[model samples]
Target: MHVPDGFIDAPTSAVAGVVAAGALAVSLRGARRELDERTAPLAGLVAAFIFAVQMLNFPVAAGTSGHLLGGALAAILVGPYTGVLCVSVVLLMQGVLFADGGLTALGVNITDMAVTTTVVAYAVFRALLSVLPRRRRAVTVASFVAALVSVPAAACVFTLVYAIGGTTDVPIGKVATAMIGVHVLIGVGEAVITALTVSAVVAVRPDLVHGARGLRQRLKLRVDGELVDVPAAAEPVAARTSRRTLWVTGLVTSLVLAGFVSFYASSSPDGLEKVAHDKGIDAGARPHTASGSPLAGYGVKDVADARLSGGLAGVIGVGVTVVAGSTVFWAVRRRRGTDVSPASTAGTGV
Candidate 1:
């Protein structure tokens, strides 16, 4: 649901921009604690993967479809703060490179799609994890529930934003009902994809999944009929594949999904698009500023072969997003390292 330019007026858009900026600033600071050698690179990969999977839109209702929002998937696989950054990176690439979303409405997209989904999904996921059995399957279950709730929550937020700043005359009540209704169906697809992806990663390397971090090899010993946590040294070395192998495999999977599988994605409008058309929510929609770019509309300019052009665009998008996201995360990690080094050196001097 990319809100094109003109859907919201200047003042509301500015306010949303401020909110998004603040959220991103907070995320950058918080991500330092979440990103490490292993997770920083994986976080970049997660962004690329989300970008790729989003291209493979699946049918929801008879005339509508939905794609992976990736908030819950990212939050479960990585950390929430990093997950927000991941989706934001993808949205940035989509707006500037693919012209998929509006540059003027970047804040709306970020606030609605990136921030709302990540925050809500992670909140629900953590709540579930706290109460549910601390098993690997429970993580997948939580991912499903989190994703299921996130999509509609995002739609609800969008409705509120529209109610306040919508450029059209649509009734707020009708817009909310339609947006939430269609997005609820879309939420099912989001849940399945998030759960399956989380399950697959957790299966291969539970240690790599941020949500699965402490759940693995949690040994409980019985002393005086009470169970106590085992020390880290007592835990056996996990039977795991090399990180390099997993990274390569994940990258290849993302490429395949975007370059080949995306061709088969449903051509129907997505839930938000359908709702917008039905409710006149996009009456004031303006053309994307980057409409003339070669990569605009997910196709190469002057390329007649639809499959080849789209595939190439998808591949290029994945490459660019990964590089961009990795650079951002690497810089953040390096800065974090620099900050820690001074403190460590001072402590050592004392």
Candidate 2:
């Protein structure tokens, strides 16, 4: 959920800012281990795709809609640390460029949407994987459950945060109930989106799906009544799709989703916005600082045609998010290389 400014007081927001910064710092380091030549670029595409899919809000209830939070999808496709960074990048772009999320509440949004969702979803995903059959379908199943849980988890976290620093006097219990209740319905949408997206990628390039890695069972051959592992070379190699092809395909899909398909998305308020309006949580909400930006509210300034303006804004958002995410991930990948370089380690005895 994109928490707007003034929903939380300055002190609580400041603390959240510190927490967000620390989490991001740790994720940056952890991402080095997750990103490599094959997946770094993919991670960027994941972020852009998340940004695109989020624009296509689906109706959840009479007045509430839901969109992809992306944490579960990202974590399943990439890794959790990188997933956090991916969603955070989308949040940053939305806040500064689209004026959707408030700048002052950036930390709150990141903590609630990015950090909490990624942590909870990834935990659930791995736990399920441990017990479920190690197959592609199992991975998709885990993704669905993980995504389903993650949305309510985020709602709970937001409720907790609001209880501590809420500007209004709304009863905490009521807020929690309403928030969780509505988001539970929203979670279904999240689960479907996450599962379908993960399943599609796993089908095309299981190697590219980080969570699905190592899912293939080893070949067993019985010789003299004893089972032996098959030689690696003896195994038939599956036809491979090039990473560039997948990347291009994903980018094109994102463009199509955001640039055109987004026009048909439900226009009703999202889960958080609906809850806030219903519960008087927005009584203290302040205008976004970037509200005056040309791309504010996901539309180009002075654009006569609604379709063209929104399309342009969506396309621009995808382009910027992909570039920014790619730059960050590539730099992290480079840093990883530098850290293991022989020249850098030559002077220091291991």
lDDT of each residue in 1-350, candidate 2, tens digit only: 78999889888898899999999999999999999999999999999999999999999889789898999998889999999999999999999999988798899999999999999999999999999988778999999999999999999999999999999999999999999999999999999999999988887788778899888545789999999988757754334777889899999999999999998999999989998999999999998999999999999999989999999999999999999999999999999998897876887995
- Measured with C-alpha atoms, the lDDT of residue 55 in candidate 1 is 97
**Worst ten-residue run, lDDT, model 1?**
232-241
lDDT of 1 by residue, 78-183 (tens): 8999999999999999999888878999999999999999999999999999998878889999999999999999999999998899899999999989989989
Candidate 1's TM-score: 0.94
Please provide TM-scores, in order, for all candidate models, with all chains considered together.
0.94, 0.94
User: Which numbered prediction scores highest in lDDT against the true structure?
Assistant: 2
RMSD of 1: 2.5
Model 2 misses residue 58 by how many Å?
0.3
lDDT to native, each model: 0.90, 0.93
Superposing all C-alpha atoms, what RMSD in Å does each candidate have to the true structure? 2.5, 2.6
